[model samples]
Target: MHSLPESKKNHLWRKLVWHTDTDLHPLGPFHLAEVYCCDESNGYAIWYVRRLAKDDARGVAGVENADYLLQYFSKNHRDAAIERAVMLANADPSADKVIAALDRLAGGAQKVSADR
Candidate 1:
């Protein structure tokens, strides 16, 4: 809903950077967020709740999957990508802990991703 300051966007914004090689390199099974590739076919964020021991191509296909938490797309644009991430975190039962981590990202990033 709001824009983050340049400094904060650089530091707090946990983005998945683009890579030319392995699509999986930037996002293994453990990453919280990866760069939203503008060029990629799958326009969504991969949220992993657990560490992926191996690259399970089958993916977290079921609701019973405890490792793969969610996959989503944010049509609002760039910063919105992280926004969707926050929403997912907040929805989690461990919202307090997850929110704390996101808050820390803001601190380390020197900015918060709006109060929402």
Candidate 2:
């Protein structure tokens, strides 16, 4: 959880803290899905990615501007949620497959948009 380097840690933390800041980026270990630590607006709001669909891309925010499934306030509690997200992404084979399918759907969207 806390094993990330200071630089990456700072960036990850800020991605949650500074939500509106365009410069702050999301950390993506899995394709099309991302994990945000916390944000300044909401205290330690962590999100988890479950299964994603092509249209699940709605309400996208953050630097990656992707979708997330669960978001809750943690009242200064940190790292645990991020750790959970990482663990969930790694441990859940079904979620991984869903992400892959979503990725392909997203790719098709890009191609359609390009053709337009």
For residues 1-116, write the lDDT of model 2, one tens digit per residue: 44976534432432211122234434522223544454434544434322223334432321123344344446465666566545534543554453444344343232111111
Q: How far is candidate 1 from the true structure (C-alpha RMSD, Å)?
A: 14.6
Give Cα distance to truth, residue 37, candidate 1, Å.
10
lDDT of each: 0.36, 0.39
User: What would the per-residue lDDT of candidate 1 be over residues 14-85, giving only the tens digit for each residue?
Assistant: 332211234656553343322222212344343433222233222222212132323345444645556666
lDDT of 1: 0.36
After superposition on all C-alphas, the RMSD of every candidate to the true structure, in Å, is: 14.6, 12.1
- Return the top candidate by lDDT: 2
Error of 2 at 97 (Å): 3.4
The TM-score measured for candidate 1 stands at 0.27
Estimate the TM-score of every prediction: 0.27, 0.35
